[model samples]
Target: MVLRLNIDQIEPATRDWICKVQIVEIGRPRESLDKKCTFQNLILEDEQECQIRAVMYTDEIEQYVSTLKLFNTYLISTAKVKVSLTSYGKPIHRFYWILDKETVIEEIKPSDEVEKPLSPPNKLTITSFDRIPHLMVDSTAEIDVLAVVLHCGPQKTAGRSHHKCREITLCDNQQNQFLFTLWEDFGEIEGHEIYSKMATQRDLLVILGRSIGISTYQGLSLQTRYNSTVRVNPNYPQAVALLNWAKQNKTMLLSSPSDTTSTSSSITPMIVTPSGQQLLSIADISSAASMGVFCVNAEMAILDEFQDFCVLECSGCKQKKRTKDRKDFHCPKCNRKTSLVPRCSFQIDLIDNTATTTASISAELGEKLLSMTAEDIFDITCTKRQSLSLNPVHEMLSTKVFDIQLRKSSWTSSNTTTTTLSILSYMEKQHPPQSTTDRTSKKIKPLEISEVEVMPTTAAAAPSNAVGKLQPPTPTKKV
Candidate 1:
């Protein structure tokens, strides 16, 4: 039933392929043509290194995926061969296999006849957040980044296709912070472990591979590409160095014993109460020793006019919707006629009398602040021909002092450092501050590297000794 063929012998007309292959990498399943498609890149050995791209479109995609476990050899048969298309995301191989419902795959038994596995096409280099801006704009350069987990957002279904993603905060040694997004398969499964680790105050190290994505909404965010893996608290030197740095520099400023700890992570504001965490005035925030999350009591000075506040989002990809006809919205990405979802984007200026800064808040949080969804707000502002003045928002927040938690992140470009502050949380009622004696410093325990998940069967699996020498880790066991 298996017609074993060499990689060079296969042609586009080949209908069946029975070959021994070691699964190199598995791409997260992506939705296409209203159906989910899974892709896996495999390695085959000959006089020279060769690769094969395998795709599954059948309903048994999950079953097939489980069979082609990473690093495991398989005897795949009846797979239809085809010339790889440049539009199929980005492929590492020139030829691809289309496995429909009729294809057969079986685990290759361990024997001397089986050839040695070939290394995957990965150079595993750990990069810094500061260097991200200099990288080639549209190149498929696989780079790795290591950072500390700051905050993990609730899993939200996104895009016009309604795919799920969990947004998280990651910070580096330079105190630079960036947003990292975990897509659908990861959001549903591995993301819970990351959330738990943060809640428990566990020192978690995150390493992302081949993530090069830029967005206007979240500046300099990292996205997981095909075959990429997220490793938490990996047993590597960089992880240890980061842990030591975090433990030593958890607080941004070196404060007096009586002063409140200036934390880079989340800080519950202690305002209007005899409390634990000391509150910093808006002017005092910029002068603090380090860059991180800060808490302050500030009133809304001015709300920007609502001229382009609300935009139409495509129901399929969640991208901005455009149209020639006002009644019908079209998605440029999905190329489909889709329903429009209204969302808000606000740039509100806040002032505590001591200082002023502009904070950019996305539509979801804007909805909470205004107590109205973007759709509802749009109707009142545009549908009714109401003035673009943000009188309603101003009236709600003006003169009302709020205990606000702000995250201060900085990045350097062109030999200049630029700092930006974004609101994390705010409360109308002040909460008591925590006492320094009540706080417990977390200890970094030496991780058993063996407990880390099995590495991919590639050079990326090499031991990490120095910076940029990172290997993708297996999923952490749920705590």
Candidate 2:
């Protein structure tokens, strides 16, 4: 036979020893000293919402913590209650619970008003992603849904701080993505392999509980709440279907509309020399400007040992000085030093990309380029040692061949004989642009440029010869 006792009516046992009792309320626990010790605050609604300091000792914690499911009724018989004072002038009850060897957990049940399942709730319906509801859900509400795994990995040191967190990105067909972050020790999971496996194969659906929430990283994530469950299987039919859909609509889903705009804006075409016959690549000008160099493509041939610094007339003051004073290399035209010396040292010439008719890269952009090698800039396989010795002509030559062969040139009039001589003089002055012998001596490493095999723009447009239909595995019980 089952016995039920009113929490408020229980009188203090004469022995003043721990007694067996049912726990009516398991209010949210309070964390103190950085969540080291959790203070379970409970209240006997029959008596009052009076604050109670229920301390779970470390050893006792191991037992009850696992059984402390949210919103589930539990029979915690072995517990000690004591009187404690609060910040206010009133006495409250404090329960110190410990599980002994003899303690046994009774049957766990959903809270009052248990709903009879029509079936096993096989058809799990997932509505739009919503915020985790404020109210607690009982174990009966457990359901499964097909969710795309966006990101998953073990916790790492966040920023410069010592705190660790695991970040996961998840998305669904609804065109919504959520970032899930598991904090502290909970962040360390099996490994990154789970994430890696899911990344290559989209349309993965894992069983999750309502305890999960949309994390700060804007991803759907789960916590170690008692009811949470997860599993992955390649054979699951639901998984197979979702995978097929994702593969079919991969291009439509992954392609961003703004990509076209950015691509077009970055490809700037301009003529750098007066001959105007040889069209200079806009990227070359951007690269030179970023390196603090001021010269046309024709003049670039003459540079040998690239200097670390350059002098430019300050666009603001029109005074020639080392371009280092202002953040954006501006000259102090309005200052008193402008007229006293007839030219202010503050006046710095802006390194403008005359080809694109734009200002030169700031000091920040130069620092970025310094960290990158010529190989990184030109997407070549030259060694680092070779990259350091690379001259402007070599940089131009490497890019010019591709431009000439692959793209159409916009020619201009004026093929002056002096232009050829000027170009030759510049090339001679530079470290005799890297010879074929030097390139051969450096041992060119095989380039690893992955060929981008573009897929059809739409599922319907896909070639009939396409290999297989994308399909996810069926949803099965999580192991």
Candidate 3:
């Protein structure tokens, strides 16, 4: 004969008792060594709510600890009962349960009983955000949910880091957002790529195996297990539904307030100009420089020169040990050897129209022209000349009118003191030959001299213009 008993009808008087009970709830064990207390709470419901606290010794806890997991239904027997006092001195009943080494745990198979009254969909469940619970389901279970993608990093290769995992910001229609991490190695869907694709397409759908709650900076978040399956496609029917839902609930997912503050607080690159006027192009420099442009300056001198390359002195100290030469300059400031060294320095090298001379200009005045491109250089020389009154020396350099600057010195009669200045303004003026005319006009063939042939003649000529020669007016007027 089979006997049925209600959970509430079970009496503590049944000594050395053996009773069968369905596990309505299962929880993780809590232990307190100072209080000499260790227990796990289980709830049973057989016509009424019955809560039982199962106590265990340290030895028994170690024996069956691995076999216990929350939410698994079990039939526990050989449990002892006792009365315990609450913090308020109220008496509470507790049970001391143990599973001997020889006792075997029999897995209870779920019944195929027909459903009775279904749970109301409107019932609200309270859960803690600090510790999210994991939901376990069989491999054959099917589920549907909505999720979001939060962060994505670069993809990696076999020998490199992998990029299959993506952190997601998920939410249900309940106005709640949770973080979900998806791993792609398993059959799980590609969440990051899907979210990116759907951002343009406007919707996504996902189906997965299990949901586990984990702690994150943003509180408790849900994650997908390896067995979870996700499907995201523009063609999915659920995606269409989600799009329609989003359209109706436009204000639900508002942008986080933190994002606006971050974007507004960003730093932009600093722009500095002497005239405080914005320059549009290289041609704009004529107007800009004429108004005194802003530029950084450094003191430098030519240390070495090669065929077409020259190195300038760099401002840095060098360490020195034993050296064969004892007369080298040493910088006591840096405690290193000090000497002019070859380094790249920005300076304008003037090239005349005749390709006859090139002179290096110092400071900001020099760097302005050197920084222009070949095309812009040609444009500046051909046009925009009047606006700048660009020193006559620079004009000749830009036009390639001649190839050399004259170096000259003068001695004062009273003290016989000598002063020297180098000027780049003198050179021959040779225009290209005019096109032949049909009438009696003579076509003069302009002489063309190569740079190599002009070097010796240029060197032999004595410095005539101690001060630079006056520059002629430009072909056009300033705008």
| lDDT values, one for every candidate | 0.52, 0.31, 0.31
* TM-score on alpha carbons, each prediction: 0.42, 0.29, 0.24
lDDT of 1 at 131: 59
Angstrom error of the Cα, residue 40, model 3: value is 4.3
TM-score of 3: 0.24
Higher-scoring candidate on TM-score, 1 or 2: 1
Candidate 3 per-residue lDDT, tens place, 1-479, comes to 32344444445555433334444333334445355866444433222334443444556667767655433344444345444334322112343334454334433435524422211122112232211222111222222344332222222211012224444444444433444555444212365555566466543333221223232211123444422334442323444555556556644443421112112122111111112112132112212212111121111222111111212221232122222222346555445665532221122222211111112332212222233332233234333332223355344333332222222222333333222222211222345223311222221221112222111111101111121221211233334
Using TM-score, give the best candidate's number.
1
lDDT (tens digit, per residue) of candidate 1 on 1-479:
44567666777776556666666445555555445553433433322345666766546566675566666666667677787665424454567777677777767555636554443333234677655544423445545677776567677765535667777666777655556677766665557778877778645445444333433223234665544556666545666678778767656511311122112122111111112235788667755535544567666533335334566655566555443123655557668776775665555555665656565444444555665667666676657756554567667764367666665544443443444555644555343323211111221121112222332211100111111111112233211
Off by over 4 Å in 2: 1-104, 107-127, 130-146, 153-155, 160-162, 190-193, 196-479
How many backbone clashes can be found in candidate 1?
10
The C-alpha RMSD in Å for every predicted model, in order, reads: 18.2, 24.4, 28.7
Candidate 1 Cα outliers beyond 4 Å, as residue runs: 1-21, 27-33, 36-52, 59-66, 74-79, 83-89, 99-128, 135-148, 156-164, 171-176, 183-186, 209-212, 224-479
Give me the candidate number with maximum lDDT. 1
lDDT of 2: 0.31
